[model samples]
Target: MFDVPLMNRYGLLAAAMSVLLCATAGPARGEEISLQKAVEIAVQNNVELNAFRKEEGLREAAKTKAGLLPNPTLELSLESGALTGNSGENAFSVGVSQEFLLAGKREKRLALAQKELEVYRWQLADRERLLRLDAKARFYQVLLAVRKLKLAEGGIELNRHLYQVAKERLAAGDIPELELNLVQVELARSEGAKTAALEAVLSSRAELSLLLGGSEVDPALPTGPLEAGGAVKEAQGDLFRLALERRPDLKALRAEAEKGSAELSLAQAEGVPNLTAGLGLKRDTTTVEVAGLEGKDTSYTVGITLSMPIPLFDKNQSGVREASVRRDTAGSRLAVAVKRVEREVATAYASLSNAEQLLSLYLRNVMPQLEENLKLTSEAYQLGEVPVLTVFEEQKKYLEVNQGYLEALNQRQQALFKLEAAAATELTGGVH
Candidate 1:
């Protein structure tokens, strides 16, 4: 059915072959990239996508088989030799036989193949969407990890200064040794926290590397802010309808159901026996005595043969039943997928809104006041109006609050990805 020109066909083949070979067209190693760039790299270089691109080649092969006719068979025969001779004559025959598919079986097979091709296309698209969404989430996770590490490192610096204050207060006999010792213990905890944060950075970076389809991925951080996405605008639309229209996984399930129906039709068509027929040339030779003289006689004949199976035993009943069951199963799965998408949309919408509200509240009313409180508490401790432990507690609270803001931002972005996955389409002007 394709009307592609020869040059276009070659171009398509080359593109598919490049995907099959996992040829990358991404930024070079050690280059900093945005989340969109990371997803693009993954789509272009992932071996999993390469595997999916090969499915088309397999489907094309099946299509070729389905559209083909049976080959003609040649046969030769010799009969009535001297060993079993009754008339002292030999006969030789040459024949060609052809089997004809009955009940439009070839047409049914082609329909099934076409349906399978449709299903494969949907599946590949679904996989690509899934990979891109996952890459976005993992990319943000790495950013979150880096933000946390920085928070932890800054905590150590803050705690170190507090420890110095406590030490000076101890030397002046304004604080007990026990107070200085407590502050020293908190300083050690912050040190351990920094080390833990460093470890977390390594692991999360590795995971992002894996998502980018390489172990040698750059350690450089992604170039985009975690707070740039998640508008919750899709929630205002008819989300369920949008998911039905756009989700590739849902479309794939629908195509699978169609494929199942086609397969059932193919199975029904396979029940009837095919017609086999042969056409041949035959020859006979004999020697006879006429008027006391030996004479030779030769006869040539044309013969035809035709046959078909009786279908007395198995007539593809098992095949039809299996196909019917599978088709029903596919329909049930499609229904389930639809409902799952609905839940996903609802949940992601709620999460994105919650994250937005949390970040807004933190910025407007919570974070500013908290920072002011931390500054006041530190000054009070330096003036000996508050205990060293109070300053230590305030510093911890400050670190946690800032970390919470970054977490909210990351969560909102991740929620955007989840919504995209649910809709099976990225929000327009939201993310790449």
Candidate 2:
């Protein structure tokens, strides 16, 4: 009678109840924060996300750099025969040259920078999506720990009551010392379980504190239901479609493909050599001795010149090739991302379905009978009608059944979190 399979089958359930109780105790040490609050804190204060946001500034600066024109060149020259001992012969020229971008290279470069900025925005959004998911998961873990602590406390109360009954029976000469000793042992075990459950609450809260960027000494208590109401109403195929439409990582990859296309276009534009035009004023003063007579000549002239590279060999062929490869690689990655999302949605969908089924079983069939059974068994044992072992078994069943119910609740919430993360879209009726 002491070796009941029902209690053993739901051992994990009891652990979860103990966690819940401990969570309740946590509020006394620190203020309570709801799930939404936790998520907001994580998004705002997380160090990595803050650092990643700086990239937006860098991308914006790149756009400014891309749109700017090349600087104008200034040229000045003096030609003299002084070095050759003919200082009387000298010339001076002043010129300004501007290299004009040809084939719309500047516009193409600006377009590429814009596409790059889009890709980074999507990437950062995806990172925030992941961060939100992690915060929710950690919050749920703390909730589970609190529930487990509650279960442990309940167990202790039941064991203490049973111990009193056992002592009474032993004192009345109706039971042996060994039976009473068994109840004391159970009571002590319950106390130890409570201690462990309390420790679990602290550890879970510490984890959540780290995620929320809070001090561990003052970790906020999670304030929400362990069994928050939510359901997955969409079919697997529909969820997969939603993932394709909403997943930021997938969006980032598509943006990257567009960026690669822009890069290729820019590379082709760069292959067209730029035109440099110059305008200059020239002055020359020359002196010469001809026919034994000294003569001097002074002249001034204005001229315009235009020049360009021949592009005989390197026409950005390597750059074009690299960009083409990049575009192809991006396309391949997007295809792979689609497949991976499909698998994730399917897996999370099935997991949610299974958790719901288990919780339904506990709610409709098993849990309602457990309390009455334990009550009757306790009364019968006290009246000397049932064996002490029967009381122990029933009490164990009571605690484990409650534990199992909470465990199912926790598992369902965990499944919901995974589904939301996989799809990269918030689902209705999820933990709040």
Candidate 3:
């Protein structure tokens, strides 16, 4: 017979708490990372995010190009009359001209380019926001997997202990062979469960590693509590307000609309034709035949010329219309984005509330009693007051309840992440 102290020593709740507290060290020997470290790594090294960041440089170069002036054109010409037997008669001309932008087109083009750069900057900010959210979610996934693996390990040990107790009872003739066989079956099932849990741990860690831009061959280990996280206490209205003020994508759309307006201004300015003004010096050499000899006479002239398109054929009407339409479309999209963000905040707020309530129920009521239930059942079976099947049922129930509790924790943590993402701000302890 087993001692009651032995029955109480490894109670389910105590084992679960110990596992939750101490099992955060990852299975592998890789570097252990907290949630903050994971997100920082992802932002710094994620290939796609870094690629998106390069677009800012492109936009900056475009802005620089937009602000530059058009280059001047140099013209030269020379003529000889040698083919007509007048080799001494020749002319040479040199000219320089510059095409000047009309109607402030250069300024407008530069404005549009500047607006485009602003839009891209806001978009990059939004991309970073989304990357942070994704990294947090993946970290939570790894935490959930690790917790499950630990729980599964504890289940294996509990089953092994029960199996040994059953063997002792069987040898002393207190229990039948079938009881020992049943305990053996439970032990095998626990081992199989552990295998599955370990697989889940590996898979989740691999995903996190990829997100962090780490090598899959040596994935980083996530170290955090699955149950520990923050929740928002703000009302849905307040959260939606914060989202409107903070969402970078919304700001990007606003900047895009402004850029469209600048585009329209530039298109209108483009309808005005540029003027090319030139200054030239011409030299002419001729032989005079009336002076009884071949005396040479030279003449020099200076002239100015101006030219410009008439704008009678095309006036950039299509370009103007296109820009107007683009502006309107951006405005419409911004309106739609506002509505979408509101919806997202509402949905996330509701989800977080539900998950919090469910987790609270588990923590306050269900999880508190499981240890006593398992301990009492095990002691009763050891004293021969209950059958072996009763102990098995209690143990099975303990595993199921803990699994449910772990799921609750994961759901709650995910709900918090979604809410923070929707609002585009951190909501720790109900404060932004």
Cα TM-score of candidate 3: 0.92
Off by over 4 Å in 3: 1-31, 215-220, 429-432
Better of 1 and 2 by lDDT: 2
TM-score of model 2 relative to the true fold?
0.88
In the range 1-432, model 3's lDDT, one tens digit per residue, is: 543355453464355445533433333344468777888889898999898888788999999999998999999999888989999999999999999999998899899999999999898889888898899998888877877787788777777767766776777788889999999998999899999999998998888888888663254577667774655668899988999998999999999999999999999998899999999999999988875778789999999999999999889999999999999999999999999999999988888899889989887888778867877777676667899888878878887888788787878888888888889888873322
Give a tens-digit lDDT track for model 1, residues 252-346: 89988998988898898888999999999989877777899977678999989999999999889999999999999999999998888888888
Candidate 1: which stretches are off by over 4 Å? 1-31, 85-88, 167-173, 176-178, 228-230, 291-293, 311-315, 428-432
Candidate 2 residue lDDT tens string, 7-93: 432343344334434533333334478888888999888888989999899999999999999999999999999999888999999
Candidate 2 positional error at 420, Å? 2.0
Sort the candidates on TM-score, descending order: 3, 2, 1
lDDT of 3 at 346: 90
Query: Which of 2 and 3 is ahead in TM-score?
Result: 3
Q: After superposition, how far is residue 93 of candidate 2 from its true place, in Å?
A: 1.9
Clashing pairs in 3: none
